[model samples]
Target: MCKKVFILFAIFSFLLFSVVMGNWQVAPSSAEYEYSAGDSFTVALTLNGDGNDIDALGFDLTYPGSLLNFRRAYFEGTLLDSWMFKQTQLLSEGVLRIAGFTISGAINSGTAGKLINLVFEVKATASDEGYIFPNSFTDDLAGATGDTAIFRVKPLGYSVIGYIWYFSNHLPVPNVSISLANYLNTTSTSGEFSFDLIPEGDYVIKPEKINDIGGSVSPFDASYILRYAVGLTQLSPSQLIAGDVSGNGSVSPFDASYILQYSVGLIESFPVSRDWFFLPSEFPLDDANWNSAPDSISLSPLDSDTSGLDFKGIVMGDVTGNWNGGLKKQTAAFVSYRIEAPHQLSQTKIEIPLKLNFNQATLAWLVKVRYQAVGSKFLSAEVLGKSENCIFVSHEKNGIINLAFASPEPLGNQQIMVSLYFEKENSLSDKFPKIEICKARLNETLAQIINLRENDEFQASSFQLLQNYPNPFNPETLIEFSLKKQGYTTLQIYNTAGQLIKTLISGPMDAGNHQSLWDGRDEIGNLVASGIYFYKLKSAEFHLVKKMLLVR
Candidate 1:
């Protein structure tokens, strides 16, 4: 019985040792590769053993026929290197059959490595994911099959996505041109841009745009720039670049003047060569040398999808950074003030004073006036009581006039801001020329003019020459007067002998309140003896004289 048990054990051991276990697979169980159409790639077929040898192997390698084409297989340094017979053939559209055997003997159970290398050429545009799988592993000597190998080919390219925004408001900027490699795309309404099918390589992305240089460029921009130049305020790097309208590398009053000129339509274009400039969103805000920084984004050896590569747009003359990428929708506010000039067509000339009734002080104002009457033509305009530190500009196009004024300090109310003069032509029609205020702003805020007062009827009776104060006993006196019309006027002092003593005023004067000072002097700047003096005010339509006693 013991001998029988020993024989059975020996038989069992021989049978177990003779069993051949084979595991066939591709070298890389699963892989992903990128390739453009018409490109070529390779994969290896490999085998792993469970201490069992296989003399022959056969399998079918399947792939997407539309994306890949089968090429020659290589076995120079694989397990099938010394095989006596090796065969490979295309069984169908995308199915490849590979078979090999060695007549020398079965391959050593421990000898396991790559068997063959399968080559394929990309036939067309690849899908998102393409697979090359090995199936039906059968051999002349075999055991249990092992895990299958799957080779996945991904489309050969990455995506680049980004956005463009306005530097001031962070609003999306549309219609901007974005470039990567040799491809170009325009931004959508949402200010988003994207580029696809980009191969693996270093690339530079650039943005470009052409816009109106004068958009959103107003007197406020000039004021802001002036403040920055004088160290009264701060400016960002981009603002500094925009304030340099002359392209002179620095901000100055000259640039402010140029910008103001452009805003008022004095100049058609800015001195800067480019209307818009773009910078990467990641650009440093503290970079004082922003002008020297690269205006493009660089991707070195880009291999995957990249997004959020945003940019900021800067308009050249918009120092206040109010440009909305030329996409702004503006609605004028209600009228805050009105000046009425009710004159018959019989009058040859008319003057309209823009007087505000509000008591609020303002630092800036912009008024747009429309004179649409066919019988009247605008002659000229002037600002009354204008401060020395203030900047004022007026532009006239067709029958419209734009008046922009900015002051470093707030101007008091109840003052005449501007006076418009017009010349009326003789016409038989009784229609009065319409002088309307189309728009008005007070320091960037809309103001309303509730009443339109007719000054023509009240103007003639309003002229007056007031009595001098502290008269009869002073070396100096103040004389006040009011004019109903704008014309060449004169104020003179004379002695009782009727000889002219001194002329205090002699020039074209606006129709408003005026004052003059007489220091008891003669025409040659000599002090006169204490005596009686006559002061006279004369204009085109009015004349008056008053007497005062000068005492020493």
Candidate 2:
């Protein structure tokens, strides 16, 4: 009997305490708001409960005078499906009333949930002097008998005001977009993106539209140096793995190089090995780095800076090299093209000559030709006549043509040469028949740029080592050869015993027809009795020796 009495007393005391002090209290007790006269904002009504079931609710509210004009009331996924009474109306000129209740029985909104969303616009003349906006929400009064068995509710709200701005180069960025939860906004010309009304919930904001998408391995300014350090990259290890341009199992340096090559149309396959982590299936390599981890000011490595400043955007400070940043050119080569519509007819034939100046033997070469494609132009490129040294030639899409050449033997620098010929992309009666070699790669690096405008009078067809005019001469003779493009060129005269007699020409020469008069003398300028002599012309991919008679 004594134990039962003690338990009963304890229960009674707990119930009395529960009835005396409600378990919930509206949070953030107070807040303030300020905005421009034309700005509109939302006020979110929040309900926090003490882990109790709330079947129904009733609330009354009063607001500041003429400061805010109620626009709309909206809520989704709420506990109350039916409203017995709901409204926002002016009780008096400066005071507004909001009253609402739930119809059906017990609903549990434990801890927190949005009870209501109200949009309000400040009057054109509204000022920050008094900005006391929304009313204190109150809920407690019940039905006729006052049944408090279900839920004790608490209300909370916050003041929404000024927005955030995104700027670059000391100017506001316009049309940049960002969103949080259910709120979305676009930046104005002033670079300000605003969300006037929003629920106070845990939110993850997403940003977009700052710069053109571009490379990985971003070149860092002073700020990003810390952000992209080896172990401290702003990018996660996963993101760094995505920076692996070749998908070679690590975020290697080659990724940056591959990005730049892809941008310029040097490689057909994107990233050459498609395994990017972020939105891989959606974006291309054109402006790829913009997808993540670049830009100096943002300081956020996870978010990408889609601008032209990305490391992958550009590379090779001084040399022409492949994505490995290897295969740099010590010197440049030149190229030129000739197009002729014979007799002013569409029977156009195009030719391009090449000049390569290098010390090492060229292993391989790749060139891309872009043309103003006309009817049958694609057909013309594939079937165009080329030299026997060319191993492969094919037409790629979009008026691009790929030509490649490789030699089993080491073709010395001064022995490298190439020529291309095809019917012009234009048809019969076409005014401008156009095609140009846009890019070239030797040993997989961009061929250094050099001008090969040797002969403006006539375009060349191929590398030609023309016979010496007046071969049997007393004093001198002229040796001629067609310089298709710029390259290391050399001319030598030899005796019948194969000993060098004189070196006539040894230097870089532009594309065109070149001629040199070789006097009948040795390197020492000594004239001797001559029998049979040979003159040799050597340039990139071209080597020829012609027999000549010298009578002295």
List TM-score per model, in order.
0.51, 0.25
Worst 10 residues of 2 by lDDT: 146-155
Model 1, 230-282: lDDT tens per residue? 89999888888778788878888998899878877898777877777888889
Best by lDDT: 1
- Using TM-score, give the best candidate's number: 1
Candidate 1 wrong stretches, greater than 4 Å = 2-16, 19-139, 144-150, 261-272, 287-294, 325-332, 335-552
User: What is candidate 2's lDDT per residue for 1-552, written digit by digit as tens?
Assistant: 999999999999988756533344332223545544556776565556553345444444444445556677665554343555556665665455556665554444344555566666766442223333333434542311111111111112222222222111122334545554566766554445444334334444444543222232233321232334445546433244445556454444465555455556676443424321212112233333533532122212222212221111122111111122121123454323333332332366544443434445666766665556444343432223434654655556666667666756555665334443455545454433244455555774455333244345445567888666555876666666777888999999898888999898999987766666666777654575778899999987889989888888
Error of 1 at 154 (Å): 3.7
